[model samples]
Target chain A: MSNQELDVLRSKVDEMNGQLLQLINERAELVQEIGRIKEKQGVNRYDPVRERSMLNNLLEKNDGPFERSTVEHIFKEIFKAGLELQEDDHRKALLV
Target chain B: MSNQELDVLRSKVDEMNGQLLQLINERAELVQEIGRIKEKQGVNRYDPVRERSMLNNLLEKNDGPFERSTVEHIFKEIFKAGLELQEDDHRKALLV
Candidate 1:
């Protein structure tokens, strides 16, 4: 491949990576908000029922080239990460 | 600091990071096992009650330079990550 073509491809990859990082960070922020809400309500941060419902809903809605299970698996991690971010913030607050 | 001192410090940090990575991977494997069990039992991946109990237990046992809340938060993320690993495996199985 030409140097210019390679550079363009690298830039595209970088752009996608940047977007993914932004989304992950955004999700983390949302999780923090959820944690605060749970703390205020005296609710647990880990909600199995809610998680199951989400998975089921996603399964129902999925029309995927990817498997239903694959989608669920990916989303579950995303959800869990978000939950962790919230939990971390709550813990830090409690520590102070 | 001497060059030797810096090298030793860097090595120590690398060793610690490696240990942490191993533990995290080990935890992920355990989570995959738990996921299989849950799938067999028709149980949900996220168990808020179990998670809360764990946090409370950690809090009770903590006599930390770190706060109880900090421990809880860190462990909560660890637990959540493990759960996600399992869920991912289960979902992949379902898709296949």
Candidate 2:
């Protein structure tokens, strides 16, 4: 491929990165909201059963060149980040 | 919060998920292109230096409720998935 072609692909990747960042932030906000509700109900933030089910559902829906394990690992990272965001928000709420 | 509000947040989360899925797929396509180029150049696909630099740049830019480690972990998962996608594409090219 030419330099021009490579540049074009890189630009597209950058655009996707921007979109992913925005969506991840939005997901964090939603996770914080869920955390608030969970705290109010005196429930634990991490639910292993729910996480397992969610991963199973996602993997089932995935039609990919990417393997199921890759998808699972990525989602697990997302899940962990969401959980931490919720916890941080909860801590801030407590301080306030 | 009302049931309606919870529903609203959940719906927003679902919408964000849809966006994330699209962006991730787009990223994967770009990754595959890069893979093809690397294969032609006879270069190793995995670059530890690049991966380290990427994580450092992202963490430096993170103004987050999420910790540095959380961001690092998430990016690592994305990187792994991207790498795997590239390998699979490379293998297919070899067969064809």
Q: TM-score of each candidate? A: 0.45, 0.82
Weakest 10 consecutive residues, lDDT, candidate 1 chain B?
B13-22
| Candidate 2 C-alpha lDDT tens digits along A48-79 | 98678667777776766567787777887898
**How well does chain B match by TM-score in each candidate?**
0.77, 0.93
lDDT of 2 by residue, B1-96 (tens): 545776687667765665666667668878888788878778898989866866776677666656678777777788788998898888888899
Deviating ranges (above 4 Å) for candidate 1: A1-96, B2-6
Q: In model 1, which residue pairs have backbone atoms overlapping below 3 Å?
A: none
Model 2 TM-score is 0.82
The Cα error of candidate 1 at residue B62, in Å, is 3.2
- List runs of model 2 lying over 4 Å from the truth: A91-96
Q: In candidate 1, residue B83 scores what lDDT?
A: 68
Error of 2 at B60 (Å): 4.8
- The CAPRI class of candidate 1 is incorrect
Give residue A94's lDDT in candidate 1 (0 to 100): 93
